[model samples]
Each structure stands twice: as structure tokens, then as C-alpha cells.
Target chain A: MGHVVIDVMPKTEILDPQGQAIAGALPRLGIDQFADVRQGKRFVLAVDGDVTQEHLAQARAAAEKMLSNPVIEDVVSVRVLEADGR
Target chain B: MGHVVIDVMPKTEILDPQGQAIAGALPRLGIDQFADVRQGKRFVLAVDGDVTQEHLAQARAAAEKMLSNPVIEDVVSVRVLEADGR
Candidate 1:
């Protein structure tokens, strides 16, 4: 089966409490290398055959209409998930 | 600033209600092309300097120790986010 990957991230101006909580806990884990953390959603949509332009268009439409909330989130990426899992 | 990306997904054997719900909803959106839907997480960790081997290692460590619940989820990918935002 072919798969399409869609990524959704909270808008830059939005407050991400989950990300903040993770960042706050990192130091306690003795991992001070990172300055910030942003949490987002990743979706894999599987299709019956090889991914085609039409599938991509549908995935894009789905990403916008169903996968993300436009007011608070941005559909950061919409692409095919390569066979080797890029 | 540089960034590292981490992806976490529920183990294949685990039942993903969210994914199932999404799959069930797709047809309702008139997006019946997709056969399955699996939802996961994407995390972007920001750092102040250039991304290095050490940072990658730390990201791997964090992904295992904190970002994912070993009992249910798997850390599928831990890599630099790249300058081009790949």
C-alpha cells in the first residue's frame, strides 16, 4: 500500500502547553541541549495502489479540512511517505 | 537555530482508536481514496547552535526516555530537521 504523510503544527503565535511542559521537564532529565520544544501531529494515510497526483490532492484537501484546525494549527507538510520510510 | 525532529507512533499491534476514528471519518468527508489512517506525533526541538552528532544522540535519548512510552509507542525517527526544513 502507498501512504501519504501529513504534518500539522500549532500556529507560531499559539501557546503550546504540552510543548512547554516537555521543555520544562527536559532539564530535569539532564538534557539541557534543547532550547525549545514544539509538539505536532503526524498522520499516515494509506491507499490501495501507488500514490498518484490525485491521491496527493485528496490528502491535501483532507489535511486542510480534517487533519488540522486552521484557526490554531497549520498544515505544515503534505507529502508521500516513501517506501523506505524517508 | 537548529532543530531536531522526532517521530513517535503507536506500536503496530496496538489498537489506535484515533487512527480508526480518522479512517472512519474520511469517507464522510468524501475522501474514500484512503484505506487506512494512522496518527502519530511529531516533535521539533530547537537548539541555539549548529546541529551535531551529540545533539542527535541526545535527541535519541530524549525520544526514548521521555518522548515515548516504551510500553505502547515506538520512536520511529530521530534526526536533524535540516536547514531546508526537510
Candidate 2:
């Protein structure tokens, strides 16, 4: 079996309160190396066979249409998952 | 100038209701190539300078200690964002 990975992130212009909360809390954790934080969603879709080009297309469509809200989120990426599970 | 990407996913044995919902809805959209779906979180931490080994270490620490709940989730990856934005 194969899997397709889809990444969805808030649009740059959108306000990400979750990310802001993380950024605010990081300093308390004594990890102040980060300047900003953005939190998003990742999804893996399992297929019955190797992830073909058609699977990618369906994943992209699903990402744009169902997985993310286009008005506030962007479908950042849609690709086949690597064998090593990257 | 660079960013570290962290990926967190629900443990394999855990129940992912959100992913289940998505998987249940896919066939409604006439995209039934997928058999299962798993959902997770992706975080981007923007840094002031290059993403060094120190930054990766810190990011990994943050990912484990703050970004994910060890009981229910796993920090699947912590790496520097690619220049091409992959």
C-alpha cells in the first residue's frame, strides 16, 4: 500500500491564534530561538496500491475542496509519502 | 531567515475521529481512491538566522515537550524547511 501526504496551512494573511499562542508560550519553556510559529494540518491518505499521479490529483482536489478552507487556508503541498515515512 | 518544520501525528493505536470523518466523506466527493486517512499537525518555527544543528535540537525539544502530547501523539519529524519551501 501507498499513501499520499497533504499539508494545509493558514494563508499568510490569515490570523493564526493557535500559532500565536505557541509562540507566546515558548519563551516560558526557555526555548526562545524562534521568532514566530505557524501551526497547520497534515494528512496522510492510504491507498490500495502505489500512489499514482491520479492519486495525487485526487488528493490535491480533496485538499482544496474538503481538507482546507480556501478563504483562510492554503493547500501548501500534496505529494506521495516517501518509503522511509518522511 | 530560515524555518524549522515539526510534524506531529496521533499514535497508530489512537483513534483519529477527524481523519475518520474525512475518510467517510471522500466517497461523497467521488474521490474514492483512498482507503484510510490519518490527520496530524504541522508546525513551522521561523528563526532569526540559519537553521543550525542547535536550532534543530531546540526544535526537537520543543516538539517533544510542548508541541505534542506524548501520551496520544508522536513527533514524527523535526527538520529545517527546504529553500524551495517543501
RMSD of 2: 1.0
Top lDDT: which candidate number?
2
Residue B1 C-alpha lDDT in model 1? 88
Candidate 2 lDDT, A1-86, residue by residue in tens: 99998989999899999999999999898899999999999999999979999999999999988999999999888988876556
Q: Please report the candidate that would top TM-score against the real structure.
A: 2
Q: Cα lDDT for residue B25, model 1? A: 93
What is the CAPRI rating of model 1's predicted complex? medium
Over B1-86, each residue of candidate 2 has an lDDT whose tens digit, in order, gives 89999989999999999999999999999999999999999999999989999999999999999999999999988888876555
TM-score of model 2 vs. true structure: 0.97
Question: Can you write out model 1's per-residue Cα lDDT over B1-86, one digit (the tens) per residue?
Answer: 89999989888899999999999998888999999899999999999988889999999999999999999998988888855444
Q: Which regions of candidate 2 deviate over 4 angstroms?
A: none
Error of model 1, residue B52, in angstroms: 0.7
